[model samples]
Every structure is written in structure tokens, then in C-alpha cells.
Target: MSIYVGNLSYQVTDEDLKQAFAEYGKVKSVQLPTDRETGRPRGFAFVEMETEEQETAAIEALDGAEWMGRDLKVNKAKPREERSPRGSWGGGGRSGGGRGDRRY
Candidate 1:
């Protein structure tokens, strides 16, 4: 079961998240999205549990629970949107940096 947790403190680590939810059941994984450049937490994360019961319990118990002085936002994760292939920009094959023929 997948769960969405938001409003996380930037200092929270994956182990902190795991320990928080482990009180209810086994956690499969905890993913905290971070800045690709700075490696800082993005204030949100995805937690996967072993069963729906555990997921529901986590959501109910932690949905508004305070963590690191902030109330966490917990819910079932929504399906992620599909992404286009890399470099396949919808604007007719233009690369990200610039158009070759256009004079800057």
C-alpha cells in the first residue's frame, strides 16, 4: 500500500519516516524526494507499506500528527503522470538549450 506524506521538515530522514510508521506495521519503502542539485528534502515523501490495512492505519494515525513540529499530510498516493521520453520535447524536436538556427 502506497501512502503520500507531505509538509515534512527538510531535516527529516528516511529512517525517521520508517520509525514513525513502523509502529503500526512493516514498511516496504520510504522515498523522500530531494533537490537534484542541492540534495535537500522536498518536504514530501512516499511511504509504501506491506498491506492496505497498514496503509490505512498509517494514514489515520499520522494524517495530522505532528512531526518535527509540523503536522504531516498523509494520504493514499495518486498515480504519477506519464512522462514523455527524454529529449522528446513536444515543440517539434527542439532541444532544451536553444534552437540551432535562431540567432540569439
Candidate 2:
């Protein structure tokens, strides 16, 4: 299981996360997603450790701990929910009216 690290500073990087978690144990991987529009860090990350014991230790040590000027929210990541495809207007394409409805 991977750990969900939240309330991170925008400046945080993958290597930074790896280093922080490495103190507890071997860090398997770190994923920090970025905003699609502005192309900036999303202020959160997912850290995968080599073992559950190491993951637990990291979570206990880091949760609510102040780091990078923010209180961290570290826990096991929940399974990502499936989202429906979005349209140009950000809707789920449920609205029927569109360019096809206009007949000049």
C-alpha cells in the first residue's frame, strides 16, 4: 500500500519526498502529480515504501508533522475513483445542447 502525503509545499519534489521517507526505510517510489493547466506541483504526493512496517513508521512519524511550512497529512492512499469523461465545458457530456443544435 502506498502512503498519501498531503498539505505539501508547492516546491516539494519527487527526490525530496524520497529523501524524507528514506529515513524510515527503503522508499520504493514517489509520485507527485502536477496541475494540467498551470503545470505546477499539486501540493500532495504518494509514497510507496518497500514494506508495510516502513510505511507505517513513515506515516506515524510524518503525519501532522510540520514540514516545509505546512502540517503534513500522511496516510494510506485510497483507491482512485473512476471519473467519467469530461466535455469542453467541464461537464460529463450530459447536456445535449451544443454546436450540433445550431442549424444556420
Candidate 3:
């Protein structure tokens, strides 16, 4: 459903991405994330297709192909890892400061 596209031109828009993938299959969605402070294109995007076959076709055709003056790095998007709170540990097998329950 999701494909990660890297090394994209900042000038690219969501519609442009959709159109590019349209030849492979129906594009469900396209997301081009931007910088928090600048709101500019982040030079990468996540494209969603209607099916896995369409996704695989897009990956096979677009991966390493030259487009918009850069080679594309297209692949299946991996699920994001769960994140812990800013200062809290998620109990990933590490000692808590190694201080025997001592408090600062």
C-alpha cells in the first residue's frame, strides 16, 4: 500500500507523484512531508497504491530509474517504530542508571 520514494526533486508535488505512478496502477495517495520550520518539500515522499501488485510494479519500474534529474530510490515503506516519551525508557533490557533504585 505504501512505497517510500527517496531523492526526489523539491519541486515535485503530490499530483506529480501521483501522475508518475498512475501508469503502474491507481495511486491511492501521496505524501510529501515538509520541514517543521520551513514548510518546504522534504525531498522524499510516501506513495500509496491500491494494491500490492501495483506497489511491486511501481517499485520494479521506478527503483534506480532516472527522473527529475535524480535517480529514484523506490521501495516498500516499513512501518514506523514505536517511540517512547522524551525522557522515559521503554524497558528495552538496559539497567535504569545502574544505581539500585537511587533517585537523583
TM-score of each: 0.80, 0.82, 0.81
Question: Among these predicted structures, which one has the highest lDDT?
Answer: 2
**Over the stretch 1-104, how does candidate 2's per-residue lDDT look in tens digits?**
89999999999999999999999999999999999999899999999999999999999999999999999999999999987777645756656887788767
lDDT of each: 0.93, 0.95, 0.94
- lDDT for model 3, please: 0.94
Per residue, candidate 1 scores C-alpha lDDT tens digits across 1-104 of 59999999999999999999999799999999999999999999999999999999999999999989999999999999998889965785656655566775
- Evaluated at residue 67, the lDDT of candidate 3 is 91
List RMSD in Å for every model shown. Answer: 5.1, 4.5, 4.6
- Give the winner by TM-score: 2 or 3: 2
Rank list by TM-score: 2, 3, 1
CA shift at 103, candidate 1, in angstroms?
Answer: 22
Q: Indicate whether candidate 1 or candidate 2 has the larger lDDT.
A: 2
Q: Name the candidate that leads on TM-score.
A: 2
The collision pairs in model 3 are: none
- Total colliding residue pairs, candidate 1: 0
Total backbone collisions for each predicted model: 0, 0, 0
Q: Candidate 2: give the clashing pairs.
A: none
Off by over 4 Å in 3: 87-104
